[model samples]
Target chain A: MQDIYEDILRLAAGKIRQRIRAGDYASHTAGLGKGKLQANIAVMPERYALDFMRFCQRNPKPCPLVGVSDSGNPNMFTLGQDVDIRTDVPSYFLYEHGTFSREIHDITTLWQSDFVAFALGCSFTFEHALMRAGFSLWHIENDKTVPMFRSNIETVAAGPFSGPMVVSMRAINKSRIQEVIAISRKFPLAHGAPVHWGDPSEIGIKNIDTPDWGDASPVTDDQVPVFWACGVTPQVAIEQARLPICITHKPGYMLITDVDDDAEIPVIAHSNS
Target chain B: MQDIYEDILRLAAGKIRQRIRAGDYASHTAGLGKGKLQANIAVMPERYALDFMRFCQRNPKPCPLVGVSDSGNPNMFTLGQDVDIRTDVPSYFLYEHGTFSREIHDITTLWQSDFVAFALGCSFTFEHALMRAGFSLWHIENDKTVPMFRSNIETVAAGPFSGPMVVSMRAINKSRIQEVIAISRKFPLAHGAPVHWGDPSEIGIKNIDTPDWGDASPVTDDQVPVFWACGVTPQVAIEQARLPICITHKPGYMLITDVDDDAEIPVIAHSNS
Candidate 1:
């Protein structure tokens, strides 16, 4: 199992996709395929494509849209070869008119020609880069989901897609704040740098212990909470718009891609050797 | 004489209209307002509005559209009070079917009900900031127009707005590269930072001294020629489209606005700051 874990970390897209397709492995894919890009998935009716695309354009921080697919074909050729959206992710959320309806492992039966899929860059890639660069992460150390909150910040309205931006919070020591910002900026497709830091109420988070989604984590006395725009913002926008139907990956389940993570240009010129 | 600069800048928006209405102020608007925003102007027929808008969206570095007025109406309420597009700009270049027809100081005679005016952010504001930040500008020091070149890099095209990008080059000492980037990024509406640095040939500039437009400056061995996307790119596209009639500011000539130069937020820090 240890040998398999090491090999999976370096596996190519085809092998990983095959494992995911066959249901041979079903755990969290956070560190799997170490350097490939991963994204949050939002599937919706084609009728809302224009409005949703505009929403992504207007609020690039929270919903940094990477690849938008043509109405209903599952193959995202731009993201990777033979990438099937219907069965790519480990899990999904089915929403109906702004409410949580249910969760499904596969949406192959629900696939439609009128559906559109938007792949948004996730923070996991940047988080990985930061850790490799020696920046410590509290949520990762404690094995908890990063704290998330609804902020007072308003997203630019696009047709019916309008709502407050949701952000993920991580506590970073003062000494490493610049290091974290430098590493994360490279992945603009990922949420990028912290939109807000220090005080939580400034962005409308009432309490640090309670989060709208995900497991809560504690903040140490010496650390300040750094907030990054989250991928979940688009999902929140879909819910707020009360679209008749929409589907998204369950909070932590993401669509892993073939794009090499190392392919990204680090915004920082790493300190000389 | 210096005391008159402010009064001249504060003329009743209506009175300014009268002089522009009468074909006065035919020179470039460089130092007219002293501390007000001056914008690059683009006038196009309504038929090409949406595509041109999308082109601006795709290529924001060169075309940071500040204000886009409604089709046919020359009055731009957002830009200034009683600001008439036909007469506000100091000079206009009329391009007919991809050819230069004539240069005119005012365009009331050529005004069409379907014409739309787009106000783009110019590099002048950022240049001012750079000077205040203590960076020396070679072209401005020499009292010459900044060097501009047609690069091999192609802009993302939309509809008829397809052409190679034009860039303005500045020679900066190697030690100040980061400082220049940090200062310029604050003004995104202005062309922002260099698209390419260090190697001019990498972006397809064949001769360092021979520019496609404007006078070239000498670059010392300790300096690198940094390039920023120029507003002239859209003009090239408009000329290529060969519409029956198109009007633009004659190179250096620009429209001075009543907006304060320092009024904008340098950095948007949420309450957390």
Candidate 2:
């Protein structure tokens, strides 16, 4: 299983990033890296950074900001050593006037001097933790993308960023729903816990058989569909704002960072250590 | 005990803020309010708000942002209903050109047209949780202020905000230290768990009895001196920035908010409920 590749995965983060950088790898980064922090990327001009940050702060579940690049700086130094926002992520989706443009492999030519890159926590980190604990996930098992839906939960707006919260759903066996919730709770940066369970209509999803994004996997009689705040929620808001220009990671293709998602902030100073 | 005043305290949030606003309560807000979130206040011109926010984002443990006002707006709408930043805080400390200017009861007259208010989570919330769980904090038991010291732990800087982190010391019993850690870890907003334990020298504190701020509560032989990131850290950074004008809460006087300290984001939407 995945454990057999554990050592490979550990050694893969930087190498895979290099491969992606060289145009050797340009697909979904679902299982890439050292099984550490992989982020959902959003790049925008400096002028909108503050309001966007406020929106993320207010609606943390949908947009848990894990790291941010300083204005006009492409390197996310705080996130990881030598992690460049311009080329690290495998794919990028361009947005102009809040509308999706063509997806591209690299954006070195379009880089703006004042652009700020924001890295929000992705569910992949928690999913990794959950699988490590011996739980099976539907998407990983079937080799399909996880189904995501636009929910009715209204996000608290800040300036021009506002929209319905997007959620990713997983159908878990009824017997393991509680354990799943408990496991996910430990990773707050990774969406924390399910916003709702038991009913899809509870959050205004008209049909569980269909998802707005990704392939659908209907809940069996013995499983409960659990939902988590999706990183795509921010993309939805950012898209709606119709900013003159913005760039986001093509969903499922993320920036792999050197920092471990499981690592909490250092309690002891490195100087003291 | 605080329990004796629980009922009265349950109804005291708005009334206390009203008194503080009307110039009736000019004392510390350590034990006031409905026992929810209490925040450290920082007010500065809008030009500095983005950078200050970056500072908070980069250094979350010591500067965990709980709420922020709209640019130039005094009302902290997201934190609490009718919580005005201008006069709700009991005491205000002014800083001009990186120097302490004066301490005043209110800043109603000094409120700037483009000022932004930031509310960082205070340690009081977690302290409240620990005390409610039957743990005795040395400072609470002795009616002295918690001893705080500037430590060797340097904060990740953003723009002009940079300094050594300030830590509050509590002499927790060696036996209960683990329990204290568990309890405090639940309050990430409230500085979370101890940054250091055992020896103060490990964090470059040569004198435990001589705190840089507040009263001294030296560790006993059977107890361990536990240190947590202090909210005063941001104040220190803001002061060192040499801003022409800025306002902060006096050492122990905090802004009480209606949001519960332990309240996680709603697992289900209110509209769904």
Q: State the lDDT of candidate 2 residue by residue for B1-273, as single tens digits.
A: 444344335556777788778876677777777567888999999888888987887778899888877787888877776888999998999999989999998888999889989999988889999989988898988889899999998987777888999999998889999999989888778888788998899999999889999898867788999999999899899988889999999978889887777766411123110
Model 2, position A137: C-alpha lDDT score? 85
Q: If you assessed candidate 1 against the hidden native complex, which CAPRI class would it receive? A: incorrect
Give one digit per residue, the lDDT tens place, for model 1 in A50-121.
567656755667886666565677766556767788887878899999999999878899999988788888
Question: Native-contact recovery for every candidate?
Answer: 0.00, 0.13
Off by over 4 Å in 1: A1-6, A12-29, A32-37, A41-54, A65-119, A129-135, A174-195, A244-250, A255-273, B1-135, B156-162, B173-202, B207-210, B219-224, B234-273
lDDT of 1 at A233: 84
- List lDDT for all candidates, in order: 0.76, 0.83
Model 2: CA > 4 A from native:
A1-12, A266-273, B1-10, B265-273
- Model 1 Cα shift for residue B102 (angstroms): 9.5
Residues A1-273 of candidate 2: C-alpha lDDT, one tens digit per residue = 455344335555777777677876677777777557888999999999989988888887888888777788887777766677888888999999999988999988889999988989899989998889887888889999899999988988888999999999998899998999888887777888888998899899999988999989868899999999999899999999999999999999998877676756411123110
Q: Interface RMSD of the predictions, in order shown? A: 9.8, 4.6
